[model samples]
Target: MTETFTYTDDLQIEVVNEGTAKFEDQKPQALIDLKSWISDEIKAGNIEGWLPYNNFESSVTWKIIPK
Candidate 1:
């Protein structure tokens, strides 16, 4: 199933009937944006947690700061 959604501020992403999802690798653009967003969000005292996900169960997990 292909799930698509946008990011919102409330510290959680809204998924369509799939429950929240764990993001995969941070794309080139994602990496850049994450650096800034994460810093800002953390400073703002929104959420101090990290998200980690595996890619197709290959033992390769990517850590990301969700937007």
Candidate 2:
């Protein structure tokens, strides 16, 4: 399952695979699409910050914090 959590005043997006949910492993296209969506949001002034991938595996998060 794809789960998204919004925190930090709704300016951040935290996505992950929990339990039996491993979307990245099963579908590479999903990851690509996800990044594209994130980029669009950032360009549209939705999310507020940017960072490098946070984990060992392909990243499943888009967290941006204003400076």
Candidate 3:
């Protein structure tokens, strides 16, 4: 399962995998289409602040769910 969490600032997104939950210091840098996610969050009014990825933590990790 993918769980997304945000701090006071919404610029950074954290996706956590409940199965493994391994934290890594580096993640594959790429562009992500978060239109739907952002829209949902905005509707709920959870968004707080905005910042560049450079200002956020560069490390993240998620686990594969077993079938």
Candidate 4:
């Protein structure tokens, strides 16, 4: 899915979803929104945290400060 989402040069963030998604007709917007969301998370100081005893959920949170 790398073709669907373009990464910045610095490479300090990652996005993960639990299941399949439909990006048809909104691929660009999805990427833009994803980046913006990540940027906002970093600006708000949201760091990756762990959730013990829950192996079915994702643990990493976005804290990527945009340049």
Best by TM-score: 4
> What TM-score would every model get versus the actual structure?
0.29, 0.43, 0.23, 0.46
Q: Candidate 2: misplaced stretches above 4 Å?
A: 1-14, 17-20, 48-62, 65-67
Clash number by candidate, in order = 0, 2, 0, 0
TM-score of 2: 0.43
Candidate 1, residues 1-65: lDDT per residue as tens digits? 12233344633332222213323343566435544555575567654433332432311111223
Off by over 4 Å in 3: 1-10, 19-35, 48-67
* lDDT: the better of candidates 2 and 3: 2
Top-lDDT structure, candidate number:
2
Alpha-carbon deviation at 51 in model 2, angstroms: 19
lDDT of 2 by residue, 1-67 (tens): 4444433464545555433445456578865666677768778876533333425434444556432
* Sliding window of 10 residues with minimal summed lDDT for model 3: 58-67
Q: In candidate 3, how many Å is residue 38 off?
A: 4.7
Candidate ranking (TM-score, best to worst): 4, 2, 1, 3
Give lDDT tens digits, candidate 4, residues 1-67: 2122333665455444432443334468854665666666556766432221125442223333333
Between candidates 3 and 4, name the one with more favorable lDDT: 4
The Cα RMSD of model 3 versus the native structure comes to 12.2
Ranking by lDDT: 2, 4, 1, 3
